[model samples]
Target: MAETKKYVRIKKASVDGVWYADKIGNVYEVDRENCVSILTKRGIRGLSSVLREDAELIVTEKRPAKVGERVLITVAAPIGKQAYETGDVFVAESLYDPFAKDIRVLGIPDFIDYNEYEVIVDNELKNGEADGMESTYVRKQSEGLDRVAKSLGYVELAKSSLKQNGFIGEVHTFDLLTECAERLREQAQTHKEKIERGYPEFSPVHKSAQARRDEIVEQAKADVERLRENNIRLRTFNISLEVNRKDRSVEAIAKRPKSNRAFYGIAKAAPSDCFNVHIGKAIALRRALGLGVPDEYLNAPQPAEVRVGDVVYGKYSEAYYQLWCEDEIGDVSYEVKIKEIVDGKYRYVGGGYDFIDDADLTIIDDSREGVVGE
Candidate 1:
């Protein structure tokens, strides 16, 4: 059997005279033996041949799905007529009912265990995204009103289309479109109210990129608290992992209380990828803990082109965020939906849509980690 493995992300710049393809912020998957073959200018090379102290382990965890939310099947679970295959998506109807021994989904008659599927996006955590915006409460209200105005235009178009089509005996289609428009209007109102309630005065949106980056410094302090709760065996009381995002680079500062000495871990995302705070924290923690970094982080495979459904990091004008590419726009751009912080996690949400130039996007997914070459 193949050895179970994990991913590692690089955190530092390459040194002179080194022959390995060690670049900052690239992530690579490695086997239990800490080995991965990477594609380099010199052809494929073993990542283990170089020093691994510059990379840190990446922990991938799945957040639980809630009732009425969407989930993606990660494993095949065939049960009579309600058979589910991997890569399938369905809406969950109910959560684990101790009486049923599984969870229920809309179309499936059978129940599935929690391990079989993962939440597509946690809707509850989506509200935090407004916290990332730099706009004030009044500006947010104006944006919400702008969406309502756009929705009104769409509703008018639907009505005009219905008027033209109703005379042609396509009444059912027109009715459905009209109904959808009504729902869109209702949703817009609801969104406006939600944003009003979640204004900057109450939730406090960041004023600048650096202001947002400063939160990562505090995140290190919080991470220490989290480590104490989960990693009881690890010594966390003396350790602090502070992270800061500057442009495409995320820096982590690890230190002990009142100490002049501190260790730093820095991860710079590639020009085509978004900066990730999680990667920065991992690298910084590893360096602070006096542990050797993993090999794969320095030599992971990178995507050369964007594809539909790819998760990319890029900026839409002044707002920096992740996007889910929905379709190709012309030859050099894509229609994308912004990934929002839904329930404290990043998810591809509805309504936040725009076109992004391919030149401005960076592919961030790292599933192709263990492959030997391009």
Candidate 2:
């Protein structure tokens, strides 16, 4: 009996202002046969009038190539006495890897590198075939076992090499190696037995295997979460590289435009001899985004003594946000001179300069060469 497949082409835009989700005249595959409306993967749904019956059924499936499928080699690889050239088509007999990138095919003495191959056709399901989904699950289980067996093979190879090159270590070291070798052999035998006894259950019943599967899933989720965070950071810190060149000094400015017709401006300056435009831009951008600057950016050793014309920063005031005391604000810069010295404290000649301790000031730029500190 011919299969009855349903296809749809959207004829009108959605009323919910989600036009981008589905265009006015794009075809899509639907699971239902006779429905008045359909919800697509893009989240578009409406009345029957919004859809037009499409004659061509689109079967879009994204999955790794499986065994028993026809594939065309895109890359030429030499194996044994003969070479498999590009454009050679073959039916894969067995998958040697989880991704189906390495396979064993008929008429090939060695495993073929199937990574550089295009799928000619997928294996068709027969009338009395075992459930396709169930077969796929079993195949995946077998592939995982194959991987474990391959790893054990490598361990056995290493053990053989270690025994061949007689150990120069003490007696206990040799004993340890022997114990590891025995364990590896036992593991290999166990994996071989499991492969012979085909996987019948939907999921692994053993606690150790289930825990390992959960660990893999959790690790994958962590990797995806980290990538998402990194993408956000990249978008937030989008910066352009430019340098303002002034005689003996270079300045890097970072600008971030806000929706309120204003922008965040941050600038950093360095002597032309020691300036790296890229690092300067990164530092300025981080500061503009209120992020922590790397320690390597502040590489120069700060001077022990404060001199005249030296630019300095002071912990001027404490900030309070929402009635709660926040961090200390240190953006205010000051340049002062010693006007008088009393009670082992120095008073400077500047705006509101008073008897301030030396520890309260941090010298940031010491450029003036001949000026003396009094």
Candidate 3:
């Protein structure tokens, strides 16, 4: 078996100052026998003759990274022939041998992906993205919101296209993102309320570990009292998990006086304690913008029909969109919807038809007052 090793990205460089290739990819080869290769140390299979602190690419490029004129370019290269996934950022430094037919290009890959960068941008973690999100800590919280707001590849592109096409910032959406954000806030509020009601472990998704914070607090007080009565100075008390030998049942246990912050940080919370963070964020943003949630959103939204004679707009548009038929296609794919030209150049999908089946517009669903002419 050819040892099945896969790398999402690979950095190739000329080990002996002999590698060269084009910036696009596919490096050049000089002196076939003594072609570009990575230097070998005593035991390390991965040794580089490259100039930077990056892993050595086995091939050099025309855009060589010389000692003084180091240039950087971003490109994709698969190591062990692994296919590239979305959001992979690869940068390269190479030296081209213009004198001869071959130029040694040192490839440098910074292999940073969204998930591995340790920031949660998926719609799932929007509200509480801060609990453990790195971008929030590294940058400002507003930047973090913007990052997650346009986190999806399509979402980012749609925003960029709307802005580029002179659409107002508020209308920079192909779907009812604002309405969805409000919906997220409502969801977050519910989640937050449940947590406040001593049920931090509650979640619509994921199995929740029941919250025993109050019980823990009471137990902590009793523990401190017991220690005081026993003539032991209760310096600090902390809660921990212990396995019972009687029935092999694992349960939380309260112990004493570990550190100054023990009692405060000792309470039991939901697992990961980061549920509904994004929803909270969405809610806050909507309130800041003077937006309110629909009354129906308080409970389940009633099914509404999209019909003819209604005016609508594309997810990202300033021109009002017009509908095609007087019939109802309340739920259908956006691709099937006919395009009504608002202006000579500006066109939009016929309105009144929901794009829930659309790969992009499903984020909005039926929230907000969107079924009628706007």
Candidate 3 weakest lDDT stretch, 10 residues? 1-10
The sequence of per-residue lDDT tens digits that candidate 1 reaches over residues 199-256 is: 4354423223233333333444365356535444453335544444344454555555
Give lDDT tens digits, candidate 3, residues 78-157. Answer: 34545443323222112223432212221223332212211111111211212333332233334433433333333346
What's the TM for model 1? 0.28
Instruction: Name the top lDDT candidate.
Output: 1
- The estimated TM-scores of all candidates read 0.28, 0.19, 0.15
Residue 250 lDDT in model 1? 46
List runs of model 1 lying over 4 Å from the truth: 1-47, 50-237, 257-261, 303-361, 364-374
Candidate 3 vs. true structure, TM-score: 0.15
Clashes of 1: 8
Q: Which residue pairs in model 2 clash with each other? A: none
TM-score of 2: 0.19
How many angstroms is residue 59 displaced in model 1 relative to the true structure, after the best TM-score fit? 31
